[model samples]
Target: LNHPKLSLCPSLIMTIAFAVRWRDPELVGPARKTPRETKRLSDIEDQAGLRWHVPFVLFYRGRGGDAGADAGDPAAAVRRALGEALVPYYPLAGRLREVEGRKLVVDCTGEGVFVEADADVRLAEVEAAGLTPPFPCMDQLLFDVEGSGGVLNCPLLLVQVTRLRCGGFVFALRLNHTMCDAVGIVQFMSAVGELARGLPAPTVAPAWSRETLDARSPPRPSFPHHEYDPVPPTPFPPPGDMVMRTFTFSPADVAAIKKGLPVQRGGKKATTFEALAALIWRARTAALEIPAGEDARLVVAAGVRGVRDLGLPAGYYGNACACTCRRCPPPGPCGASR
Candidate 1:
């Protein structure tokens, strides 16, 4: 990542003053209750985790000096809240281990790491510059990505809190995508925020029954599931150049797109997400300039959080998402509406 061309990105302008590793204080200690044996991942949980890392960031506005006594000290509060939050979300404190089957399971070690840093830039300047993607702001603030071995050897959940010059801060996280999904991480953060706000405990305690998402014992199937089928290993091609970009859609714009979608006769109306996804799929296909006889695929992530029959509890904070691929002919107006 130190390539000269990459450094030309605007976010590199923000400098780091000091970065220190903060571990859980002895007083808070590790969670007393943890799984005894290695928690195996389901087959549906693809091995792509071996290479993927999920990066997320949270922005908090600072309370000026006159705000309150506790308001002046933010880092201490975050440490305290994190220590308390680790009690229920203990798996995050663990390290990845390889078992006999060559599969990885968490060691439940109770030793997550946090990095606290001081940034030279102010929060206002960052917001003004636009925190768009290729999310350089987050990359600049997080200190864990360097030197730490990839997902396999890195901490299960690593956090970086950058104190902006204007007193506000940016909380950045890099989690092993193999351990949890975006929903699960957000739930974990919500619990930490609740504790920071003086709540005695999280509203929903975490459940770690990876077996809950397993396929039926006999592997009975009512329909074909080609998406979840395993494929033989293939030679990996060398890396290619790719450009990362992000597009923003306001609530009003999203609503307008949904309204424009043709509704089914006497059926349910399309959701805002479905409408926007279809629009993007069509637009992207049109831009690809592929042959009409060829096929185009779109992989969409579907969360099983609230599906009644899955029997997943409110706090089942693990990988509970499935990636479904839709194949269509690269012809006129992609009408795939998933």
Candidate 2:
């Protein structure tokens, strides 16, 4: 085990020493024969910004003496479950292709990557400080295998299972963002878990009717989308020494902030999200100390699952969200107001 210390913050440094024994990645496909077909992605899914892979990691402690624990190989069991899960969600076990107009399509190949590895570190030791973001030794934990990170002609789903010294394990995956969003991936993982638990099929069946989200033949102009309008170039260059920090707000703190806000029309109170967004925007604007007359914009992405007009089905997994930009007047009035 190689000892390497990673500094998460000024006061926190963690030693992540783990010698990983990586096995050859194998292709896990659908358990049953699925039709080989080509399906075009929705316009939103084929966007330039969404053509990358999203990585996620989940850590599990040892199930010490649990009755439900698998006596067989856990990695093998998970691979088998993934193959079963792909039978219904076969599009994920495919490769992406781009045709004319940069439109992306899925060529159903029934190939998904599954890698197994063993780490010399203990899960308890890794969680000694705190199970938080900016994890130490992230590259080792979620190694991007060769030929698995491309946006086209690559496996849409890549999973790695790393067994730790204490019988615990780390599950990491890279999924193409254009295929599904966070909620969609969670649904797929839930289906895999259900198959692993010996279920006949997923409670919610998989759906891939992306054509429902296609744009109208003749684009109908609805509300003006000002977010897409061109903006003047910024006078200042981008900051190079940027640092990421996570802030935690308790329920009481959020409630207190909401309590200070003025009641809306019809006696409706401000929501927790609204209050926190306002508070954070004000604090950030003040900290940045931008010019008083300059406008500030806060962008938020909202899901369209609740919108009745879209007519999305229960198991439809795709990009179903849009970003809304709110333009603030100026630093002075924005920060000074309630």
Candidate 3:
């Protein structure tokens, strides 16, 4: 973002020299495509897409540095860990790319502003199953997180780990601004903890360069900021709509809600979020439970991103977000694993 040394690019501006050759297809005619080239487009177009700007994704992996986990020529551990970890990641190499390679994510995309985080956060996952390995990244994961959720452009990985003398690990992760917003970062770390323990990774492979307004090729023209804002104020289509609201709670109120048996009538270990959401759902259902003819629904927004690096595209300036429905049949009672 603000880094000077290793930051790749501050914005997506195509040099005049390069933009010159991009011809108006209607005026000059479509550029001739060889049979092989046409097939390549056909083959990958279904799966692969254009990302607008460059991005950087960093994943931190650490082993004890001493004669123990961090010790004893531990580079082997690094190699082994990366190998096994990325086993399901082969299709991702080219899948994640940049307009120009860089060490930091936002340097190239010219996509987002920087936000600072000083506190550590945590997230929990439930168990689920649908697809196994030997696959490309999922288009959507729990809460609709994507393997391609990094920015549409800047896709690189930054990883740092320190082996604690106490045999613990300290990791630092950095990424481009394109794929995820601030909250998505925390979800990613929690997902990583799960992955290290051999759990299923989140889904939500990002979609890129779908709109001309986002601009896949550059000389990146200046445009209205709201056009690229990921969450535009407009309402979602007929089937899905979103409302933003905030709740206030005092310490004692939260404590009472957690401890009161009435809150846990069914013997459930209700999480703060889950309990709160359930309360809202029940109250709302009771108030508006009677529909003239159909079932009611509750939806929750789920932030998404790749725990590992993804090659995205340039010209990407977006909010990088998706949602998952709570009512969707769960793999089990605990819900979905992200």
Give the best candidate by TM-score: 2
Worst lDDT 10-window in candidate 3 = 18-27
Looking at model 1, the pairs that clash are none
Candidate 3 lDDT, tens digit per residue, 1-338? 21211112111122111000111111111112211110011111222222322222222233434325523422233323333333322111222332333211222221111111111111110002111231111111101112323543322333333232333333434443333345434444444445555555434322333232222454454533322224313223354453434457677776677675343457766677866776666666555433433333455644323322333333222334433444422121223321
lDDT of 2 by residue, 1-338 (tens): 12233212222244545577777778899999998999999887877778899989999777664323564556776798999999999999999999998999999999999888777667777787556776656667666668888999999999878787777788888999999988899999999888988999999897887987888888886976656556545444357755656678999889889888887779998888889998988887677665766666677778987899889899988888887777766654344221
Off by over 4 Å in 2: 1-12, 65-71, 231-240, 332-338
Which of the predicted structures, 1 or 3, would earn the higher lDDT when compared with the native? 1
The superposed Cα distance between candidate 1 and the true structure at residue 237, in angstroms, equals: 16
- lDDT for each candidate structure: 0.67, 0.80, 0.31
Instruction: Quote model 3's TM-score.
Output: 0.28
